[model samples]
Target: MQLDSQLDSETGNELLRQAWVQFSGAESYTDYCQYWLELMCTRIGGVTMATLVLDSGENGFLPSAIWPEKSQPDEEFTALIEEGIEEASGLVHSLASGSYGVAFPIRLDDELAGVVALSLNVPHIVLPEVMEQIQWGSAWIELLVRRQRGKEQTEQFDRLSGAVDLLAAVLSEARFQPSALRFVNELAAAYGCDRVSFGLTKSRQTEVTALSHSAQFGKKMNLIRRLSGVMDEAILQRGVISYNAAATDESQLVMREHAQFSQSGGNANILTIPLHSGDDYFGAVTLERPVGQAFDEQEQGRICSIVALSSEVLRNKQNQDSSWYQHLYRSTKTQLQRLFGAGYLGRKLILTSIALVCLFFTFATGTYRVAADSVLEGEVRRAVVAPFEGYLDDAQVKAGDRVSAGQEMSRLDDRDLTLEKLGYLSEGAKLQRQYEEAVANRDRAEAKILQAQLEQNLAQLNLIESQLQRTRLKAPFDGLVVSGDLSQRLGSAVEQGEVLFEVAPLERYRVILWIDEHRMADIDNGQQGRLILNSLPEQSFAFSVSQVTPVTEARDGGNYFRVEAQLQDISPGLRPGMEGVGKVEIDDRRLIWIWSYPLIQWVKLKLWSWIP
Candidate 1:
């Protein structure tokens, strides 16, 4: 038995340590209490079940946590407590004839806050030593509850500190509506209120701009309004107010009205606490309890503490906002004075003159000209290809060599052509002899007719010889020979019409400008512009917009319109296929209007819709 007692002591101490850790780790007081009751029932062997009943004042003993209660306490259990039975006098009682149980009152300081009831299965085994251990465990549980309360108080203080810091930040900055509202919402949730709201006095009207509520209560805007009204009244009176009642009591007519309001939205018990800072009031926090529950003094004190913290924060925030506005006004006034001073005005005039001078220089110098980068191109040019199917002879002009119009670019082998020409000449000579004989024998009737036929054959042979003389390929215009080389490509067999050389004109060039779609509307046909070539950047040439294509094409994921500009002053070195940028002098508008045109259009559209 002595060994058993020692074991019991060790077990109790361990359980106490575990309960202490759990309670300290608890996020909230309600959670701590629930964990404590569950741990106690689990640790003690004989105790088949346990429960915690909190004192609800006039609401009587309210069941908070229960392990194995078969049925809920009805009016009879409430009557037993109300009648003040001696067995219920902060002591243990036996529920069954042979079963023993213990009841310990949970107190804050000396006042009874709640009761913990534990029951054992067998009465015969109810040793004094075991009872003592159970009592010791209950004491530790009570200490844990007290520590949990202290932790809650610390957390509440921390929350208030955070709210103050947030309020201070909001006051220092004028645009703090969002941060302020968030702070108020978080505070209300931390305090376990059914609904919390903050009303800021705006133009002589109290507008509840922020609100929050417990998860058990659904979102109902009317409850928020009612609570706001209560707080507003309290703030006007400059004090705190609270309401608590049974759901159906006549003495709680206000509570009944609220309860009815809540029932319509599926909520029941309700409490509202007004918040005040010094003599002034800012808002109120309201809490709703589920059915058959009421707020006691401890809960009321907690709610009041939260409201008090919020009220002070709101007042500080208001003062900060006022100071911020004052500072901003003073700073703005000082800036305005400096901006309108004579020195500033003179500077502005000088700057405007400089800007105008710069703009004039840009236009006069043709610095904004369109001079496209270009490669050598042909003008009225054609490729000197093989005229007839033949082997190529030595080419007269190589690639990049300049050739005059009608110059021989390349020649056919001409050996075969020469032979054919000679053959045609020989045939013509023979036919001519035959024709002479026929003329001499003109008197010989039928012989003269044969000679006439031979004369026709001679004429045809001469025509063939003339056609062979024109078969050599030649340049079509005065240009550079951009394509074939004589030394490299000679003796190569070529077909008729195959390209041997490309000739390009030496003098004229055009600028193809890529104008962005955004600036396309500002461009006009025939607008005078300047061209700047990358190759000859030092020289800017004047030009005029010759053509503006209405259709837009995609380039690099953006739309651009093709614009053609003709150079007014032709440079000697300029050639076809050169490229450059073209800056057309479109109609000028005010700088401000150009920048804000899109925003103005959007606002106009919005206002037009608003009018309807």
Candidate 2:
């Protein structure tokens, strides 16, 4: 062999022994690969060498060692090493810096395990023995990769076993809150985490429920808020968030919050996993670690797998905690077990009664009415507005006053108009005297000027008279004053076009039903309905739908369509602006559906939104 021709048998044998010892003694694959690189540079003449290995941990090929111990290869030389791996036979050529370059592909079974490169500062053919020497050295590299793979498999098995135990311990408890607390604490200990926090969403906000190593925490604490903010980021994004954890693979989140938090006091590495069941987001859990011990892809993946298994427990427990209905259901179930359980006589009676009621409700037919809040109004509402800007002299009518057409509802102060009219009258009389004087002198130009001034004076007098007439506001139609009452302020300044009163005829009243948007689809014009006013609850007023306004208005935190229905029989006591509950009959429906159709529709909408 070429190695035999170059080196004596004893020296070659000694070097091979040293290479094996280094491979076994070194703590990491990087160190083991470097040992061979140093050996080749010292033993082989005129060469600067490097050893590289495919690190699955990094998802890339990494230079295990580059000599002269400080220098790194340029991009071109690195590219050559990559190219050499694809070749059937290795290549040797002169480099840009006048040195010969050789790259050898190291293979394990069928896979190109790594590449070894050398730069020789001489013009010489690369010997077969040198390639053979590397062939021998590559065995140690293969061993390193094999040992690492085995160690990883063992670590993964251990992580999975611990995860199963962690989940089982929490699942043993029937209650969710305690189980969640146990989950965080046990997880912190199992993974050597500095802190682990679990949170559940309440009223659209995620609140931290349990903290590792602490049973209780302040809700308003800044630290908790900061932690919640981190979890919230993950929940809103609908994904996992990690920061400063691993260099090999990066998380998809920006993780700016983590960076700021990490800089606050201690280790900044954070992992947030959002827990969800179907479309409903339950909350999230955050794990923190100190500096120099960030979680990598493998550790993060292990956490994800464990969190996915325990998420349902957290969801169910939190739901029970936040919902009083769930608590009531559970209590009733417990009580029924005690009274109507196995051999109790009451149990049989209750079951029979329930069965009979269910049968009746299922088969019986009834009128189904869609109920909404209604307000009484005139068939035609007329607004009394100020004809022009003026001070209020008097408000004779307040709300609920009966008035006839042309009746004075309110009067603006006409004193300003009367004084201005007297001034205009004086100007008109003076201009008329000037016109007579000019006509007598026969000064044609002076007479024409006087005529123009007289016309201007007449125009001013007419405008003032019009203003005085408009000062008193009179109703256009006979109606009851429904909304406005300006009796207390005798001289309140009023702006032009300002409405002073709303009038509607008492005998011709309309009902404005504020129907919820959810039930809008069932309503149309001419639908018959009945109303019961809050003031007079004993009597039911019949009405028919006249128009369903297309516009939606917000009231009491829900969108409602204003439906106007004319009262069929207007009562003398029934007044505009009076409100009560109104129900419109949609159609005849089963008794059970008549009572439960709203809930059924709500469920249908929710299912359609989330499914598929």
Candidate 3:
């Protein structure tokens, strides 16, 4: 007996777990109600004939789902449901046939949504406990109704938003082919369709217009022909045709072409909706998805709504994008309608205002300018050279440092020169003494030779002293150090005339403009322009073209010409290698020409090259 009881307990727990899963995961209200009713009757141990009655809007209170599948509700069951609705509460009634019935009214959002009724056949069951259990279980049904309604409302809102997006995407394009292509592609992506094709009716026959994800298609292609046939089938029926490969039973509508097309596309599920504008059907749109992802009733209705909303807009675009003569005819017809048709006074006023504004702008004139990349460079760059071959002893300044005209930039070692000077001075002193001796002895030849040696020694001493003075290199003028850094190599030897530091004057600067080779014709030496440097963008400097270098430099996959310009006024922060943009002003021209010249030039070049 103990083992049996344990087994029974486990079985009941398993059943409860399953019931919760099914109840929470129910997709529709009917499924939820049916599952809930079964669980309630089984757990409460109640009786024969249980039914779930819900409000059916126009049909009044009716049974949404029934328990025991085949069981019929007796007259007493009907009475209990009516009584529950009337009293707006739970009811326990004694039936005329001696059985007892319990009814629980379910209220959602404080309004009576439905009622659940059960008939108890066992007389020994506690009536109050059964009534309480029924009432408690009604809450699950209420929750199910709320969740189902919320899901439905969310789906509706999403469909409405998608429709608006589709319409906007189609209407944004001005030409008919582009608009139709956009419409089909949007529909395909929004619905998860593999292919979406649109076709228009001409002379009672259908011609495929635009296909999703394809820019062009040949009419002689087999797939296009099949798609055209499918569209024509929908148009002939003048209604929606939906075909599922899994469904075996054929409906009343003829779908021979749809079946063939589906077979060709790996048994894809197809849905085609005939498109109508005003009172006539003029086109059709066919959507195809995978076999398992069949279009449901709600999805089909949403797609139909989207197609209907965009049909008229696509039609207008198509008419406007016809051949030249047809476009002219339609444009003339539209203008005539606006001029003479009733209730178009607002449109006429808007058209007139737009025309007047366009006329005024056509006559306006504006300055034309050619823009080019420019960089600032000093007028003259001066290089500070090493005066003699010597080792660098000390470095006081490097690149980018401002120096005076005679500032000591670097120093070379003068120890060797100092030693040489001492040797020369001692030799000169000895030679002088020898000359004095020769004079004292009255030796004319010795005196003359000693005097010559003394003079030669003096000249050597003078040369050594001069070499010592030039050891300290100095800046030639007041300017910024443009290049050369020697702080890292203080003891390194330098050759004679080797440049050490380059300095440029701060007061004079030139702008080197890199103009495209194509635009060199428009630029001249005297044209005036303004420059804005990248480093100092807040200030603008006026400049004039000085010279144009005829040499072409290939850079960044384009040929550019180097043009030199002179800055009219020097700024405080101007430095070499400051890059900026320069715009050279040309003569005044019409506003239309200023805006359309580039396009016209490109077209002319293309035409000239293409002509044989």
Candidate 4:
């Protein structure tokens, strides 16, 4: 606390450099404050005495360092310090001892930290210079305050990070005992403790459950009993407890058990933290170390935070370890509370709305229909075939074209038939003349033979003429050209009996529904239905099911049964091969049943297949 009385420019500068080196190297807050006060007194000179007053947070402004060892602050100097702190600025006032007192505030970021008050023996004219020097020197104090605060903040951040990491490790374990063990072990390693133990409140008494660095321990061990006693002390106090063999008591908490345990366990320092979740205090954690290693306020706070965060996770694992019936009972109780609870009005309203909707669907009845893809088809389809082996000479129509009965669809080449007919005629004329000559000359056998030849030739000519008449292909009825494209095959060779055109009657139409085999049971003869064509989506036609084919046909990645339904009403716009959808009404069923029956059936089938 002794300071040099130097005021010359060179001396002051040299002292300032020395003071800065000491201030920067001081190890603790009190040491640094002492250095700052000594430096200030030395640089300003004629300082009778000076005291560095620093902010002690909850304790208010308190004297940290006094210049000139063994000197204490009198009433006048203390009043100056209070006034300067109150005004948050530099202040100068006269003391009753006829000396002038100066107070300068040390501020960090516009907030007053403390005031440095001095009783100086200087001329009135030099007072302004003193104030200037005091103000200038306070910058170092402010910088030190900021550095210390930043260091504290960094330490707090590191503690928070470590607590978060330990909580994650605790949650990662799948059981209560293991998670608790991990927590205690990790906390011991992180905080440099010799041993850490956790205990839970069971049957209104605390019992040691987990121990650091030990997987298992007997319940009857004296150490476990002592640890449990320490935890119980903390739990009963309902707060953190710290015990130091070297320090005096700071609080009126009951520390009898802590003292007993420490005395028997190598005179160790002990810290016990209560574990609470929400409003219930359920457990405690105790950490121990050798003498001189007492837990500070910051360490206690960090350990409490870690315990608070991981408590619920441990409780959940404990609950999961219970019997199945207990789990079920808890689950049922929670659901019942949600259903009939006072809070959660929004949830209650939502659940009520859902229940009303489900109720309506469960009891309401509606028409149940089976839907399938359908196509328009004629009742009877007729095909036109070539009569004789010939080459196609002309084709006038193709598929999807409407034609009347007897309409010429295609014609075959007839030049060979015409030439064969001419040869037959010439031979018949020759046979006739030969027969007349035989009859006139009295040759009966020869005349009869000539007559037979003439008849045979006439029959052959008639057959040739009949063959020529069938060379032109014609439609059998007024219908749509269902499957023919002879316009592109003109002049191609055709064999006899080769079908060249297929025609379906336009007025008599039927619907061909390709129902999935899974829905085949819903279809039967005489079931009324409605059809919607893809081309005419705005309109619907009524129909009645006529037949359901027993055989299944595979198409479009599934097996389907062909269902034929007679059209009750017809439109001229409808044509064969027009595709549409058909829905056949089965019966009136509940709306839920109508919607969910298919899914239920599919699930049943899957289960049946999986069973055996």
Residue range 476-586, candidate 1, lDDT tens digits: 778776567667767778777787777777765456677777566677778887776767779878777778877767878888877766667777767655565657776
TM-score of 4: 0.57
lDDT of 3 at 439: 100
Q: Order the candidate numbers by lDDT, best to worst.
A: 4, 3, 2, 1
Model 3 misplaced regions, further than 4 Å: 1-361
What TM-score fits each model?
0.39, 0.41, 0.47, 0.57
Clashes of each: 22, 0, 0, 0
Model 2 scores a C-alpha lDDT of 0.82
Best candidate according to TM-score: 4
The better-scoring model by lDDT among 1 and 3 is: 3
- Candidate 4 residue lDDT tens string, 1-612: 123444456677888899878977889988988988888888888899999889988999988899986698888887888898899887888888888999888887778899989999988899999989888988878888888889889978877888789989998898889998998899999989999888888876888889899999999899988888888888888878888988998888989899999888634688888888744678888888887788888788788777777777887787888899989987897688778966778889999999999999999999999999999989999989999889999988988889999998888899999999999988888888898899999999999899888888888988988888788788888988988787777888888889888999989999999999888888889999999999999999999999888877899899999889999989988988899899999999999999999899999999999997
Q: Model 2, 1-612: lDDT tens per residue? A: 988766776776687678657755877666766776777665665676464646455576766787777787887688678777667347776788887777887777777777788877754654566667767867767877788888888888877787788889888877877888899998899778999999888767889988988878898988888888888888888988877744434556677666677677536578889988766677898998876777777888888878877777667666666678877876787577667656667777887899999999999999888899999878888999988988999889998899999999889999978999999899889989989999999989999999999899899989988888889889888888888999887788988999899988877888899999999999989899999999999999899999988988999999999998989977889888899999998888899988788899999999999999
lDDT winner between candidates 1 and 2: 2
Better of 2 and 4 by lDDT: 4
Clashing pairs in 4: none
lDDT accuracy of residue 308 in candidate 3: 87
Expressed as tens digits, the lDDT of each residue in 1-612 for candidate 3 is 999999988987787778777777877767888888878877776467788988867898889877788788776688788988999898888887677888888899889999888888766459888878888898887877787788778888878888899999998998899999999999999989998999998777889999999999998899988988999998888889999988874668898899888787634699999998644689999999887998899999899989988878898888876789988876897689668777678888988899887776689888888888888998999988988899999999999999999999999999999888888888888888899999999999999999999888888888888888788888889999999899998899999999999999899999998888767899998999999999999999999999988878887899999999999978888998899999988789888788888899889999999999
* lDDT of the candidates, in the order given: 0.61, 0.82, 0.87, 0.87
